[model samples]
Target chain A: MKRIALLGMPNTGKSTLFNRISGASARVGNWPGITVDLMSAKILMGGHIAELIDLPGIYDLHGFSDDEQVVRHFLANNALDLVIILLNSAQIDRQLSLVLQIKKLNLPCVLALNMSDEAKRAGITIDAHSLEQALQMPVIEISAKYGDGLPKALQAASNILNQVQQKPSPNTIRQLLEEDNQIEHEMERLIQQHVQIPTSLSNNATDTLDKILLHKWLGLPLFFLAMFLLFQFIFTAGKPLQDGLAWALDWLRTDVLEIAFASTPAWFHGLMLDGIYNGIATVAAFVPIIVLFFLVMAIVEDSGYLSRAAFLMDALMAKMGLDGRGFVMMLMGFGCNVPALMGTRVMRSRAMRLLTMLVIPFSLCSARLQVFIFMIAALFTAQQAPLILFGLYLISFITMFMTALLFQRQYKSVEPFILELPPYRLPTAKQILLRGWLEVKHFLNRATKFIVIGVVLVWLMTNFPSNVAPASAGTYAGQVGLLFAPILDPIGINQELAIALIFGFVAKEIVVGALAVIYGMQGDALMAQMATQIDWVQAISFMLFTLIYTPCLSTIATLNSESKSSAFMWLSIAWSLGLAWLVSFVFYQSARMLGF
Target chain B: MQLLSQLESGQSGIILAIEAEESLFHRLSALGFRVGKPLSLIRRANFNGPLHVRLGSTDIVLRIADAMRIQVNTR
Candidate 1:
């Protein structure tokens, strides 16, 4: 089997090409000991099985950017049969510098000019034959988006692989570390000789779009509107799917499964229905929202507005020691922290990524909002509920920013801001759907086990010894809650709420359900009983704790996987737990002192 | 020579020298910033933020602080 790696600057349609060739068989998994995963697929090329690896888009192989380092590391470690260097046909003047740098490595390579159709639309043309002669490598002009010239490109790669020359040594990469200022001059000369770009080309589409999109006054508002519509679409479209899944699961557990398991032991039935089935249901309910969120996000990212959004928000985000892209991820966190955390890949700087990860958990994701909404409705009047919810949002933002400001210094590295604004192009439906499906698949593969284990563990804790009532004072979960009751007393979280917090760690959406079960009541009855148990101040404190405590198990698993560091994951958990306790303690103590 | 950040919107300039650390200099050069290459400031973001710059049809967004490190000749 031969190996081929797709290398290119960003926005070069590398992923599109990989997806087009690999189709639905692409597999994304982390290489052993690598910090992040690269998408790879096994495809038959020219009657031979070949492994195609799609690397992260990099600006320069010799540069110190995180993505660059990743690419360089991958090249040094893996002996590839061919490196297909993809370049944007319309932006070849600048992109060719990377090609030259890679050429100096003396590796077997081919040059692929992608987006040739867009280049033709823009009145740009490249002399592929002359360029190939000059570069002494096969040059393939292909439009990955439109399926143009891809077969020829793959055939050229396969031809080179058939030769099977000796793999280049790692020392060639070290040789590229030396700066070569002459590559730019050579690139200019090559373009001047072979590339025919019309002088003073007018009727520019990107410029006209950028004029309005990046307008000094209108840019920020347009960005917010785009974000607003995106989230609104995700939720509006996803809500019905989520509700349908929830309804089906509930019906299955109660009506269908209850009848089927009538003859089984009561303990076995409860464990199967309440423990395993509930765990699977909780993870399944999130599928629609996660898939929809990434689908729209892919469209935005591919359309090139995502970088513009970053450009517009940079100055404001700079104060918190974050890149503008971090702001977008934080907003996405409000919907679901798991996807938002995965979305941090948009930011290339390691420091920005880590800092963003620290802050996103405090975004008051919708799961936590469910808990707040329930608590607010049960405790406060209709008018007061909205204002109190608004207050919680304010606290969320404050805590997010505070977290960023606090951790920025420790993670500070000299990461300069340099972002590319690719020309706008309508993303293909196939590409968007592929991205959404792959992301959902990845989420399911990586996060489902953690979520199921967490939910089942909580169930076990609340229903152990097989003698006592589930979630009752005699159970293991109840005993543990009592153990922490005194420690939590300062924040007004009693033993019952303490037990709910354990279930909340699995998922915040379960907090209300857990409370209802622990109290052995349902719906309105549980709300009335809770209204009599905890007052307004205690309710507010509990809400605060819910807002800032440890993220759900899936998010924790995502953090561990995304960061590829258990230490950072543990730190994130401890930090959020500490912050939640401090905030709730302060608020509860001050309110008591003020006679609220 | 004036800093790239000092160039007015819509004004084009020739790159002179980039006063930055090795990493940033390498990054800028790879993005087509050379001693004689031409680039234009498309726009400045609000509140003294990043500048939208175009170099040979490639548009880049750089913070004002980083933009200050790139020297260019307006003429």
Candidate 2:
């Protein structure tokens, strides 16, 4: 199959075009680096199946950023039949330089003057015929957002694919690299001749909106209020759906599974019902809340509020040696650390990317947040619950910044932070749902495999040595928990809690499941049992320990791949474990000394 | 002529030159912040934060320290 590469500067509507053509729901945010990884999908072009590769956006082919390098390496290594060089019609003067550079590569290419509709609304006009004449390539005006003039663009690319035969000579590329200034000058001349700009393009809406959203005093307050509302929405809106699912699971376990396996051996029933079903059901109950979170996050991100939040937090983040974009990724880490860690690909500097990755595990993702909510509801009164949860989030942010400060000296190279603030547009329902669906798919993909393996492992440790009582001190899990009891004893963690922490290494949500099994109760019964067993102070210490402990199995796997250094992976584990233990010990000891 | 950081909000200027490290120079230039380009200071974040400037149709936020290195001629 023939391959076509999509190339353009950041926020040029490249990914939107790719999504419309390929029918793949790659994230379409109004910010840069949303498509950090290359995405390819097979599409029928002129009745022929062709694979379209969507590369990360770049400003110049010779730029030294990570995204630029990814594009440069891909073009150098991949065999492509045609290149679709997209240019934002509104910013043609600045965007044309990249087109000129691509032309010097001697590859057959088509110029897509994208966002023509927006340009027309701004009272700018472009002569496509004149641009074609100057560039000696087919030029088509397109609006990827509204799906206008895309067929012509695709037809032009298909025609070019059939005609281009040979790669550009290395000597030609070298020559063009040496004459970069001349190329920019030529691009400026071409834009001057073919594009006409209006004298005054009104931006009253955006200006007014920025005044309030980016206000000196109101910015931080508004940001926190927005976040707090989002958190409240997730819980309030998701409670009914979560309760229904839990009820259904309970009925299935007691009514359906019990009757179906009535004649099976006792051990088999125990393994099936007490071990697998209960464990999985506990994790599944939190799925509704997680789904709602990503939905709200997608809406906020698509609406362009996240960039404002980043802008507002830049000064505070810089104190910890991070830029606003890094802070945005940390906010995303609150939802899930895996995607947030991947989002670090947007950072231009390698040192900054690594530094951001180190602190993300401290963000207290939803999985860990689930454990906190469960423990809080189990131990605290209704009014105190919100304050405790809020405290945990505050500590999470403080720990992340503190961790970054501790390692700031090692990463000395701070690249100049330059981010483009795209004009806000209302996100379409289809786009918003697509982002939510993609996030749900990612969560399930990671959750299913690891949750199943983790739950079954815990089950085996508790149920093995078939003669002993289930989850008793003589069982394998109980023995392991007993071994760690002395070390955790000072912090009020008993054998059962220690075992739950062991299972938590797989996924934090499993900690709740492990507790349910150890106590031999479910739902309100389990909460009641927990209340009787652990006091509020000990519960808070336990929550703190869980919040700051090592990243879950899936996160560690991603950290290894993104960081690409086993040494850093090990360092992350050692640091998080040591910190969690020290903090919990201090909290527990001090509270007891103060007569709590 | 003065540093861009010295310009108050809503003031326009022409970029005279940029004096910074090599990587920062390339980054700023690539973002259409070259010499002779007209730009305006939109706002400065509170507490000595980044300077939000508008260059052509694009709004960029950069550190105050980096903005201090960009020489501009206010008209």
Candidate 2 positional error at A474, Å: 2.0
Docking class of 1: medium
RMSD of each: 18.3, 17.8
What digit string (tens of lDDT, one per residue) describes model 1 on residues A43-161? 99877899999999998876657888788778766767788999999888779998887887788888999988888986688999999999988999998899889889888988888
Which stretches in model 1 have alpha-carbon errors above 4 Å? A1-203, A259-261
DockQ of 2: 0.62
Model 2 agreement with the true structure over B1-75: per-residue lDDT tens digits: 989999999898999999988988998988889999999999988888888899997888888888988999999
TM-score of chain B of each: 0.94, 0.97
DockQ of 1: 0.66
Which pairs of residues collide in model 2? none
Model 1 residue B28 distance off true place after TM-score fit, in angstroms: 1.0
Residue-level lDDT of model 2, residues A545-590, one tens digit each, is 9999875766775577778888888888888888888888999999
